[model samples]
Target: MLVNQIDTRQGTNSTPEFSHGNTLPYTGIPFGMNYFIPQTTFDNTSWSFSPMSHQFAGIKITHQPSPWIGDFSDFIVSAITGDIDLKADVTNQMGSYRPDAATFNPHYLSIYDQRYETKTQVAPTTYGALLKYTFDEINPKIIIHIPKNGSFILNENKNEIKLLIKNYDSHFNDDFKSYASLKFSNKFISTLITHQDNPKYDSMILSFNNIDELLIRLATSFISYDQAHFALKRLTNLNFESAKKTAQETWQYYLDLISVSDYNTIKMSTFYHCLYRTFLFPQRCFELDSNNNPIHYDLYNDKVKKGYLYMNNGFWDTSKTVYPLFAILIPKEYHQMLLGFYNSYLESGYLPKWLAPDERGMMPGTLIDAVIADAAIKGILTKSEIRNFLKAMLKSANQESHDTRLGRMGMKDFNNYGYLPSDKYSESVNQTLDYAYSDFCISQVAKLLYEDKIAQKYSHSALNYQNLFDPKTGLMRPKDSSGNFKSDFNAIRWGTDYTEGSSWQNSFSVYHDINGLKKLYQNPNFIQTLLKLSNQKPAFKVGGYGFQIHEMTEMVAIDFGQIAISNQPSFHLPYLFEYTDHPEYTELLIKQLVNQFDDTMNGFPGDEDNGSMSAWFIFSCLGFYPVCPGSDEYVFGIPIFNKATIHLPNGKQFNIKTNRNCPQNQFVQKRMLNDQPLKSRSLKYVQIINGGNLDTELCLLPYSKENIELPFSLSN
Candidate 1:
């Protein structure tokens, strides 16, 4: 939502400001900024803030405190006592591997403390992680003089080392900028490394206020263990100068991978976070130690027998949205990401789940199938090696495609039966829908390379879900093995037939291709039958698409209480209306959903899968969404942010001019290609790919236009 028609950021020429995510801060967003941390949540792990001088501004993550290593000591002890090999059991130890019930009580927390005081319960974000956990800038160096000269042993984790400094005499008066300089009676590193580490899932930019804050953070985070500075012992054999050079080079190299031309803040933060999230997985294994070569994996990995590179907590779920969006926004890296998946498959015999350094043990489903196949077709992964993996993808899809325990038990005999077999883990209408969608993706990859027979085979498998769509109720629902509608379940219940929380959700789950789905209803009688579902009420014991469910949105259940739209499984549900006569209704629905679920503060409806969940918001606000990953297209939806400039990776900038209207004027009126009249609810893939800008004219029209063909993006 824009206020007074002002952009949240007015390009890069303005002063850099930041917002405390946990509290209301007048400061704008910080970019290329380094935030100082006075505390961290990785429990009991010792750390301190000491940033290099030239790293500019930064901030810290301050909101809810998180469960730290200190919080997990008992768990660690158990893992170790149980002889849990650090490498092999790293995922479990990381707290990411647990029964769904186990994770309900814990949270992922990263934040600085007591920096900015505010009225909100969320935080007083004063500083960042003390050790200045970054070194990506040129001449990135920090001089830490132990107050009273303390003896400290620095501990290195998956990426960087940390420590605390205090009680130094040569101090600056309360002059703000002077606080950034270090006063040392004892020699620290003599030289320091210039980069820091962040998980692959966040933005590398730290948000901060001033040099003094960064220094004050270094000055007060922790007490000295013994006075004698650990630096006197460690720099005995370090090539700090070359390391600094390498760090600068790494920054430039990463920058080279994508373009940043939009509202610099949005593009940089968004792009950096996308890149940062990658760090969360395929763990960073090799670092330049004076001479560059792979060191044994980091302490966390070494302890867990995991490698240096970790892909982190998110996987195929985001690959559907984030990874595929990157295919167009940042194609080269996405290509590399595909290869990384391929290689992980080769080393591990299956596509790594979250890839927490390529661990295929977490999460359900072989989701990589959709991403890989999509990437191969879009030319993002044009290598023959990828072609080989496509074959592996097929095998993986066939062997591990879990079609809800019930869908496979002779349930395909629809019309004759009204319900699924009354077994514990089946109905599987939802699972079957996704499986069919995945099959469609597989078929697309086969088709792109002219593998006609392979494509034909998958095409049939992909359509298998059509058998589940019930004509009487128009719901993608369950049927008995004899094809009769299930008597025990209501069409509005979300849990009985699909993933997460319903048919309202599953009915719209077909993301691979939309036209095929529309064809399913082309027979007028079939379309009318499905209309009854729109008015169905929630049949669940209790639930609403709210922040509690996470993917904040308006969730309506069909089949009693089986589908909840506020969860990831149902995140893409609302747009299903775009495939009907009520396209504008779908457009209005998205705006209402955004208002209900997101704001500038907590921008998502639920636990954002890495950035997969947030990616939906980002792109939708830009007037579209990447519903089907790897398709090189975005389905038309609604734009929340009044105007957004998408900096293309191709060094061009495109702006989503949201001129149509607000929640009231939610329909697309007349679209234009530059100045010429256009007739689609969506734009062209070639236009976005080749750096074309989109400008839309909107009106609060009661009816949607039928003249233009909606690109495949908004199909289903």
Candidate 2:
């Protein structure tokens, strides 16, 4: 359960509104599933940390502690019994859970949470009839009085308790369905049974689709059957008034960020999706508990653990897309996240590549420089806190011992030099290039924060990536000391010098400078460059479609899998349209990418490094991307939705909308703001700050017109 306020009301117009991103907040309130999988139960699942709503804690879950509850088991069986001296023939259709049926026995059910125990389970004396105690107090003494025909019933002017049964079916592992029924007091049903098991698979499948309907049916059943009586309002928010009020308010907050005027559906979707994407990464580590002590884990291992241990990270790649998205749309959370990262630096020497506090270590390139630098610029973390950490990392970058066993350069010195000097198993060229890029990110932050000297030093360091650029070859070739290409420089095959990708993916890796790279070639060209790269075809296939390989494996060419999308620095590639005047091509790539991949269970189409992979989908869907973070502007592109609402960093909303259908509307047919023609191609910082409506109409045909945004200028 990740979200609510989605108008779950069983009304004539209740088509159930939902956030359409890969990840959305899990309203703690149960929706599709029978039980609420808790935040502590969070994992790196799907798109976000928990794949749940941040307000999940606010949603009340009926805590029923009984032997019938089952998890990671064979099946669920109601342990109810009737002392009516009745004769009955009960089929075993309600399959077995455990061989001994004691796995979920009351006493053994490890108190997943103590709050549930205090709320639901009580002494048999506290409820009604009494029976036998368990082997110790593990078993309950409450007796379910049944009719002569072997049916269960219960109710009184007493313990206002409702009853519900979740028949965990065989499809539990696959399609995520549960066969559940409810009742109030069991007094009205002639069967005298609380809930009967069903072997019918069709009914169970039907029950899963109308999730909201099922919830109402179950709730209504409680009162209708009188087998168990309870009100949905008896719990969360007390009533719909309170819930809807909160939901609308939350919607308003996100809408204000990407303030689109004449709201079309596509613009609305983008804005909201971007807002949703920002929260997907470092999830709700802070959840209120029974005592309300904020019982969530930390993201960066912060002091109070205020932000839970949010451990998904792809340092270099994320710094480019994910972190910048946070910096613009949600700086406060971004601040907290950076603080947590610094904490991780203190705890774990040399920050981390892809890190978890418990060390789920992913890949290499200690690119915390980007985060630290940006944090300093954005005032997210103090310079004093990060300075020492960055300095301390130089040793690992330049002189640290390398271990080929670890899948990185064979020697430590290789990381800092931008090239390994005389190491047999060093990815020297790639290391140097990556190190320089990270320095560029760090420099931007220092430059912004009046640390001119520090920024310049790092900026110069960034230029080191150019050293690998071979003039004759016009590629980022591997070089030896006196400037000679590595002997086994097989541009055709990958070797110890390069990472998983070949020169095609790595050549233009120096993104900070297309011009400098242009100088490296005899003829400067973007289209030719892209066309050539596209034609090269992966020697073994790097990322997405056709031939998939074991992700993160050290294969020569097989790239596209789950982790590649999650990892690589391929995000800003599409926006090259702005620089190259190939906006059409950009639209082509984006449309193909979006239509191809979705929130599937087979991981992401590739490695979704933290939320970087998710961020790409988010920004593209929203019709623009943060081509240059801290620039107060996002490079515009064809949006995939009719509407999108962006939740900006300053707690305001911005909207983007187009003609009804989004992905289908690929061209910018007409555009307006509060019904005015958009004279400027770009949507500026001031416009978003004003918080108004932005309306756009998209077309299926290309306009073949040049409507470039305020030509991208270098901050320098």
Candidate 3:
């Protein structure tokens, strides 16, 4: 099965000095609440699980979507033999393990601790994990380190351990809490829960004797200990192999959705791993009850609510490709996730921008509007529910929440000045452009719901990006409150008014109105501007970032000019060439990017950021991309493989075949969808979901841009 082929550590080999892709070696089911990973190092704070590290701290139960967001509700479990050292904490009590020799996969993990002479194997379930420890020595022991500020109690009669964790790094207003129940096969010879003078670092250590082998079953919950026990009972019967098989089967069910047949094994493997990453986020936080009803703990209300809830997703990273990819392969889950997002809105009174457990309000704009509109436009949601979705979209667009972190940062400023002022917010230019795109999304949803008046208003408001576009530089420059462009403009300077990117990367982000943006500098100049962006050196001036940020480092690491395909801001850049006279340049750039990724420790170009980068790879390899979500059209690109067969949700298959498909023959010559020629370099969303064959002729020579229909634009 394809699931067995995935390494899960494809992009996690990173360090403070250099980062390839800051991904975790997560072993779990798709969208599982808890991911099991070997904590390679306890050094450098949040940068714990490094693929290159030789030391094994323990196996961690992590809900960390990204290192930037940090992990919460996380705990470490380690097995040891011989004499016990009570004074040794997690940092001091580490063992050396060969990272190269360790077994790492999506379903199971096995690591040999050289110091303790113990071999540990871990298998994952949705809410819990099964751990088997085999020690070479007579005295076998286990240590469980709960996060600081968390409490745990061990029951001798029930042979169960219950834990509650309240420690989160940068959290929202919610009283973030996590519960867990751990069951062991052997009797606990001795157990101690101790508090140190530090108070911040406390642990529960359990010791077992005579037994060389022990089995540990664990379950986690966000609601209560009862919920945790409920989860533990559901999976208590599962053994290591059984649990691994179950998790593998769950992953195979999703991985089988898209099958690629290519002569290149490594490339195909990379594609499958990227495909795997796309499904591992926006985890279902709700658990099934005795009646099999989904229920989740609502943090806002401080109560357990009976419904579906999803967390650990940031819309800023996922809105571009992840949701669109789901709309294609897993529409049913997509619908449920949309419902889950709506549930988040119902609880928090606003749609979330970033969520670990609740609203983090990171990034810019309410981009969930884009996800909703994309779903609505694709007709994924039922007619009965479109109104509710539209209401949520409008609420985000119009109603300003009292907390700036909950809604748009500068909603009132955008409404009053038509754009956010540079002085008010850090990334005002990004906020303005993102808000404009989201407004367009809101308008699309409103249109779908037959709210014509609402649609028209948002449609006009969507053009707010025009206010920030400086005609002189032909870039979306930051502007002051008095309507003057920020005087000092350097396109390659990173951050101030832009979010994690320079003006060169952020300017052409008017995905909704590409043609309108092109008109600001005329078509020819627009083409020249795009050429300059691609042809220029990848050099950057730190600007607001006094030192080099990781983004700057990533861009410079690759020789892809100013097109930082490593980040989401530059994701649509390759597609932007279609708006110009050089459509083949877009194809060439995409091929360059698609080549950068492979099934290795350095698989991704940058931080996967909850599958955004993975989704980019999946879409690019499939030969089309959703450049603008909320719009039905998918912009065309060069396909990497010979053939790709997508399993659509309606029991149909959408097949893409490429002829003369080789490394050198990278450019497309002709394209046909369902045996009919497509004049445009794009496909409708309906065409893909309805299921059909798309055949393309590719050769060594680039296709001529002349007389070719361009990708969809607002002016078109």
Candidate 4:
């Protein structure tokens, strides 16, 4: 029921091309390897499914993580009637469709082509898809088009087609082969295949005299065509409707895990939509063999291996909120994912920072350290597994990777100089802050494993952020190798010593040691500091980046001074108010943010990169947030819903009830945890999993006079 309410297109519509929510209306299972979308353009661009586009190119099988990262092993499937456009480009061959009359959901997508009077629907399995079509006229046809550098063959049997695609978009290798097996329902009168002069764009069109309906079952694999067929054998017997129902049921299971009761329909829809986005990443990259043994293609080794693996995620964004959500809602799957990540480490010799098919050392810091530490703290991995995890983590922190493309960059410099210098890496400020948090994560895991010597070493290393902080300016400016802070610093500048952000956004990212970070501020007036960030004019000086990046534009659009909630670094900015004298200021800011998002196409403040932004909204709407991953704590915020129930993994229910809850009633007057008076503005991980009722009374005025405990801090 909840799946039916989700549009699946909430964040696909962007203000610029890829500024806010560079997301597609993806249709697949929770962790499906392949996501299905109606490709509206034939340009083969990363953004193929714009919500406003009326053209129907085909149903694309994509493994695109983000537009900035590009796509791999992608191809298109389309249904047409009466005509063959062998030479037509995407626009010339495209059929107009009404966006309003289309069906878009997590499990299914349907579009009616106004030009041909054809309705196309598609449903997905973990590694395959079932596409059905209905035509209003006679002489129907099906087209399977592969993008640049592709070739395919139509088996003379007329029912089965074997396809192969060569894509070189990955960073791990110059090129890789992807295979697919497609089975059609009707006997084709004739099959005509075409190859453009450039040899990049190739297609096969199957013609039928007349068919009211048709079904196309497709299975894809990066390994071989036989494996692709092996993946689809189990689903070949299921009808179109049955496949649709099965996919819908699979999605409903996850969507029903958390239930919300509110009179406001838009807010409820927004909550469920955000919740839906959180489970769509880290897709399953491994498939089971004949004996149900897991096997995957090892890009690092350039061979197939027997092991479960996962890909298509960046830890920089996900470490903040995604993994913490999984620890609470789906710990079993989380455990499996950890094992998968461990496999990546075993193959590549280091944990991945960003993976799409393979390691793409993007973003700052090897943030998987936070993921591993959080899983260990939650007891998700076994004793032996944790030990292995610790070994891989230690190696990453200490050793220099064989390839500069893997592991933490400038590791030797950081170890020797105590901080990565601006001359060494472009994002030195972000590197210092990110690695500091990662050091704290390593310390947490070491402490859990009784490795006190290692724990103390990394714990001390976590304070490296202090070396970059300038108390006078209250910013973490980049430093040179000689231990001197770099001059000519502008706080509003974007991407000089920071990653897609300025010093202000990356300054307070010592989530593991907030108190240590706060002490670096001379004024210690965090409330005013946050206010300064929120009230400043939306001005920026493109520092290292000569022109304005999309992040700068998004931050200016949000107009929250310099606080760029448009990106991940500023996610915890609003909650920082709790550290100051006035905790209620956070409540107002949280309310403003939650109200900004809705259940429409252009719903997010910025790119919901791999569900980080969505997870932020989900946690805030539930009245808590995992501000720091390995800390095992969630900072309290204002709840948007009146009542909500969480189906905890331990079979107990965690309920949150708010009295007189509304947009106006943003402040909490009093709170009770399990009928006991609560004074803290935070909740522990144990309290949430143990499952109990948390009730709060709301008021129009701030509860400023009350003495409330601050969120979990290292000093406290």
Candidate 5:
């Protein structure tokens, strides 16, 4: 099964200094409310579960999206065979575990502790999980650690324990709490709840005298303890094996959406693992109530609201590729997500940019505009819903929020100066470019709703990116309030005006008007500029960030020249070659870039950033990518697989076939859609969803031709 084929630790071999995908070995159902990971250390940091670690801390119930964002409502469960002193220091209680023998699948997790001589297995449900422990010695005990302010109640008669904890990073109410209920199969011979002035040391220990085996059914809720109990009912009649099988089936249903036929087992494994990463984000923050209606804890109002809500996603990253994939393969789920985003807008008064349970307001522009616009163009949202979302988009574009993290950073200045001034805001170049693209997306939605005046306004604002374009450098330079480019402009400098990249990586971010950007350059001719970007040495300077950040280190480590595929800003760099006459360059670059990924511990070049990189691989493997989401077109690349099929939600199959697809055949010689010659280096959204065969012929030699039809550009 594809689920079993995935090593959840594919990207766990990473440190803060560098990232090999910087991902946790998360074991849970797709978009489950809670994810379980075998914690290896006592440090409550983001690097909790490293594949290289030998110490077995416990199984952590985490709601953490990224280590950068931190975790919320998190705790640990561990089993010990002998009596151990109850203390706050988890490092002392940690036991040795063989990382090679541990199982880290998406549906299940199993680890053996040498000190305890116990085997612990976990099978996940949507909101809860079934944990089984086999003890080789007597006096088997279960430990539940609450790292912060929390309290627990034990019911000896019911063989259950209820826990409530108040632990979060930010954006939650003061009274915010996470509740959990644990039902044990064996009655406790003795119970001890440790309390200390330092809340980090508090824990609950339950000992069973003679049981050789024990089972723990755990359920968690953001609402109440009763709700947690209600969620636990899902595993009431099911055993560990049954729960594991059900979790596997749940993941298989999603994994079966795309099937690849390739003889290369290694590449096939890599592809499916990338596919697995795609469905692990924007998790359901809502819970099913008594009547099976969805309700969520609204942090904005500090009350439970009746609607669908999702969290742990940054739209600035996912909007590029993740939602586009969803639009093509799973429009139903995409539609529901759109509704959830709209609900967030209704509650928070602006569309979310980064939502980890609530508005993080990270990144530069309100790029969720692209997600909404893509859905609007694809007809995934209703007319009224589109209208409502358009209002939310425009509000963020015009009005500044009281909390800077809730909406666009420099809204008033952007409106006044046509671009964010470098002196006024950090990463102003990225902020300006992102705003322009967002404006273009706003225009798309406005046009769909027949709001011609609003469409014209945003469409005009979309060209504001031209204001910061430096004709001499052929790069997007940062400008001040007086409309002068920054004097000390260095193309290789990272993160002064750009968002995690330098001018070489962030300059060509003109997704809406690539043709226009090209026209701005005459001597280098934009195509030559892209060549310079790819051919130049991977050099960088500590620009705005006085120190070399991890992103800079990763970019240099990958050695992909100035094209830092490790970050999102450079995601569409290779595809930009398609806008030029030399389309074969894109094919060559994509083939080279994809080789960096595999189905191992070091699966990605850098932080996957909530499936953005994974979706990029998925799209490139299928021989196309969504360069401009709101533009309704996918720029062509070279397919990596011999054959693949996408099962669309509309019961149609979009098949992609590549002739002579191997390491030798790196360039596209010819392309056909539904047996007709595809002259343009792009595919329309309708053509994909309607579903037909997309065939391509690959050869080692580069194919060169003039007057090649380019992708969608505003100037065209």
Candidate 6:
């Protein structure tokens, strides 16, 4: 079974200073409202859990997408046996557990506490989870670790506890709270609520006298206590085994969407592991009422709103791969997500950039425009929806918001000067480049709705990237408001004008018009420049950040030259080679890049960023990538698998077959779609979803001649 093959710990071996994937071993349904992970530490920080740690703190229900973002509405559930101080710190109560012996599955989690002499397991549902505890001795007790500003009521008569937690990192209302209900199968002999001076370690303990085993059903809601109880009531009829089966079935349904036939067990495992990460983000933020209507807590207005809402994703990362993959495999969910994002626009004045629970707005540009435009071009959204989203896009592009998190930064300067002035804002070069690509996305949406004037206007704005092109350095440099490039420009310096990258990495971010980017260079020609970027020494200066960031460390660790696959800004760099005469370089680079990933705790090269890097691997393994999300084409690479099949949402199958498909055969000699010669080295969105066969012949040697039928470019 695919679910069995997945180790939830794949990418959990990480710390705040260095990351392997910077991911947690999340055990829950795909895109579940809450995920339950085995917490190994009691640190009041984002690095709360690590697979390498032997300490068994508890099972924590977390809404933490990235460690940098922190967690919201989170709490821990643990089982204990011997005498332990209730008011003591969480680390004091933690027991030793063998990390190697623990089960870390998507649908379930299991760990044996050696000190407590108890075994704990959890099976998660959409809104709730079923927990089982088996004790080796009497006096089995359960501990609930509540965060600060949390209160709970124990109803001994009903064998249940009601909890209210008020916690968030940022971008939440004062009234933002999570209500949860915990229903126990066994009656507790005694219950005690302990308060600590340090609010982070507050606890409640429930002791069962004679019972050797117990079952706990827990449910939570952001709406109200009634809704939380309702969610718990839905789980009342199911046992641990039944709930586990349901969770497994739910995950299997999504995991089975793409089937790969490869004899290499390790490679196949890595593919599935990466695939598992792809569906874990943009989690459901809305819940169904008694009438089965979707409703959500609106952080913008602090009111209960009616609609399907999703959260915990940053469009800056996901716009590159996740949504585009959804366009091909899960259009229904993608369409619903579009409505949800549109509803966010209706609630908040602008569209979301990064939504942990609400818009934390952590990245550059309102890149959701790319996601919406990709869906619009693929016919995944209605005309009315497209028009509504286009208005929101234009609002963000043209207007500045009072809250910098809501819309594009330096919007007034960007609109007036054609680029974000370096003097006005930090990371101005990235802001300018991202805004230009977003402008192109807006143009695509406008063209879909047949608004030619709007399309043309945004298309013109899209070329604003060219404003920062410094011909002497052959890189995109920052420009000041005085219409001059910034002096003392250094291409190898990190994060003064760029976003998490140096000019060497962020320069070629012209996703909508790579050929146009190539036109800016003369002596080096874009091809030679790309060669230098790939072969240059992997050295960097901590320019703006002053200290070395993890991204810089990760890039040097992999030694992939300026192409920092460790971060999203460099995701499309390798694929850019496809537009030049040397397409074989792209195939070779993709093959080498994918080797950095595996099916272990340290599975990824760096922070996966809510499945952006995972989707990158998924696409690269399939021999293609959505380099430009707003564009409807996927640039080709060499397939890693011998055979693979995509079960399209429209009840069709898209098959991919690679001949001489091995690690050694990394270059494509010939390509065919449905048995016809495919010379363009690209595939259209329609062609993929409509279902056909893509056959490629790969070899060790490069193709002698250039295949010039390149992908979509504004200049073309």
Cα lDDT computed for each candidate against the true fold: 0.41, 0.41, 0.85, 0.85, 0.89, 0.89
Q: Give lDDT tens digits, candidate 2, residues 213-255.
A: 1012122211122211322223322233343344344544543
What lDDT is obtained when candidate 2 is compared to the true structure? 0.41
lDDT of 6 by residue, 342-389 (tens): 878888888999988888989898899999999999999888988888
Model 2 RMSD vs true structure: 13.9
How high is the lDDT of residue 7 in model 6? Answer: 95
Model 2 weakest lDDT span, ten residues long: 205-214
Candidate 3, clashing residue pairs?
A: none
Model 3 lDDT tens row, 1-716: 36767888898877654567888889988988888889876543567787777988789889888888888888888887777666755577788899878888888899999999999999899889899999887677787776667787888663678888877754444467889999998887787776644324567778876887888899999888898999999986688889988888888889899989999888888888888889899887988898999899888878888889999999988999999999898888889888888889998888888988788788888898889888988888898778897887778767888887787766778899999999777889999999999989888887877788988998899999999887777788888899888887888888888988899999988889898888889544888888888889999999897888888888899888889988899999999887766788877888878888988888877888899999999999999999999899999988888999998878999999999988887688889989998788789999998899999999788767687787777767
lDDT of 1 by residue, 1-716 (tens): 11111111111111112111111111111111111222212222222111111111122221111111011000000001122222231113221111111100001112221112110011111112122222112222222222222223333321222333222221111111101211222222322222212210111111222122121112111112221122222322323333223333443344344333334244334433333322222222222222332222222222212112223334546765666566656676566556555555554445555543324243334566777766776677666756687677665554442422101223242212322342433536754665666666777777777889987877777676677766555567665555565676554444545555556555766676566766666444433533444445544432222222311122431122222433566556556666556677667766655543333233323344444654555555566776666465666886654555655777776666657455568777656666677666565566676665567766777554665565573234
Misplaced by over 4 Å in model 6 are: 156-158
Tell me, what's the RMSD of every candidate?
14.3, 13.9, 1.7, 1.6, 1.3, 1.1
lDDT of 1 at 562: 26
C-alpha displacement of 620 in model 2, angstroms?
A: 0.7
Give the residue spans of candidate 2 off by over 4 A. Answer: 1-280, 283-310, 359-361, 375-418, 421-425, 471-474, 487-496, 535-548, 551-567, 599-604, 628-633, 649-651, 659-716
Give the worst 10-residue stretch by lDDT in candidate 1: 70-79
Q: Candidate 5 local accuracy as lDDT?
A: 0.89
Q: What's model 1's overall lDDT?
A: 0.41
Q: What's the residue-level lDDT of 356 in candidate 3?
A: 87
Error of 2 at 233 (Å): 23
Give the TM-score comparing model 1 with the true structure, all chains together.
Answer: 0.60
What TM-score do all the candidates reach, one by one? 0.60, 0.57, 0.97, 0.97, 0.98, 0.99
Q: Write the per-residue lDDT of candidate 4 for residues 645-715, one digit (tens) a residue.
A: 99997899999999999778878888899999988888988899999999989999986635667776555
